[model samples]
Target: MLRFEGKVALVTAGAQGIGEAVARRIAAEGGSVVVTDLQEDRIKALAAELGDALAVRLDVTVRDEVDAAVAAAVERFGRLDVLVNNAGGCIVSTVPEDTSDSEWHRQLDLTLVGAARCIQASLPHLVQTRGNVVTISSVNGLAAFGNLEYAAAKAGQIAMTQNFAARYGGMGVRFNVVAPGTINTPNWDNQPDTLEKFKALYPLGRVGRPEDIAAAVAFLASDDASWITGHTLPVEGGVLTGPGLLDLTPTGPFRKDY
Candidate 1:
């Protein structure tokens, strides 16, 4: 259970949802976690709950803030073992035509550039520790599931992960991504019915929980995945494989018996 013992992990957007779950998982498994987010109060509360965690206010879009947060983590933990690029979301306008130039820039900046900023800032420390990176991408990035801007940024994360993995492989720094499906989080708080509708899209007959993605992240960041690099593990309850076509036709596709 203590796979991350003596390790220090920094998780961005760790105030809630998937980021919070990842922080909690790492801490629970004996890792020193630095929970970073724009929500100072929630992050501090989470750090308190984790007991050994350090809470840092970080807005990934800001380069200075990202650098400062990484510096603080190293200052507190002595070295950084894992960096989780978890802060990102889609804008309200999912339509490509409806998305303005500013909206496209905003989504790319927050979701893609933001992660790159954190990685650049953490690379020096990661190299020192020969650590790894676990980036939080989405199934939308791998497929056209809507949210065009956000999906573009998520896809960029995968490319970035591969590049980093190749560039830093000699240094013993691995890079990987977790592309999650329809996870039941506060992002769906206002769309409960929509979430219910999405359940049928997944072959598992249910949407994912935060812990589901967190488990994949933990494995990628742990030594158990030491030989793995430049890989993207889809943690989407069979959604990435294919939609549940049979669920749409319960009559068994016009079987003779029927």
Candidate 2:
């Protein structure tokens, strides 16, 4: 389905992993994509590979860069129909109490404030086109996922999206979030065994894939979700349903084969 035909989308952190997956999905669905990231080489290669895509070296943490990226999108595509805020990540590694103010500032600046910057820069064009914004949040934002700073920043994204949705609903510009669980992204490359261990913790018996998130973001960004605004769609693998005990496993009590 070409849900994004004749439309344009700007995705932050579109170098690889979830961001790259989202960009590919949008392009596959017939949208012109603006792929922005600090990885100049990767983004450039990806944009070239995608044909109708633009590569913008955007550091979402910087306001000037964010504004410039948005402007570039409009200039290149003639309009911006969607803004995918995919730049944020878990940066603070310190424990909650041990986390320094500087660390907290950096975390929030990158995740929370960064998304706001993109939205602020894209708002005018979105308003003109009656467009939408899809933010990639995390399940950590909804529950106690251990990383305090990261969780807080993710939660802030949810709150910010809700407010934006409410404020801009009348203008026909929607705002929503895709809160995903442990996706097998490059972030887990260092800990090869970690994703394996994480699978047992999920009720679905497997960890998430970047394509899983791309699908959710696509749904929320498309006109298919026209009435969906200010909502956080948890695309987790049913991990949020309850404690994912071993009972759900094939050999466990909850399993049955026909």
What lDDT is obtained when candidate 1 is compared to the true structure?
Answer: 0.89
Per-residue error at 212 for model 2, in Å? 0.5
Supply the global lDDT for candidate 2: 0.90
TM-score leader: 2
- Among residues 3 or more apart in sequence or in different chains, the pairs in candidate 1 whose N, CA or C atoms overlap within 3 Å are none
Candidate 1 lDDT over residue span 189-254, tens digit each: 987877887777788899899999899999999999999999999998887675553343322321
Compute the lDDT of residue 66 as modeled in candidate 2: 93
Q: Determine which window of 10 residues in candidate 2 has minimal summed lDDT.
A: 249-258
RMSD of each: 5.5, 5.5
After the best TM-score superposition of candidate 2, give how far the Cα of residue 205 lies from its true spot, in angstroms: 1.0
Worst 10 residues of 1 by lDDT: 249-258
TM-score of each: 0.93, 0.94
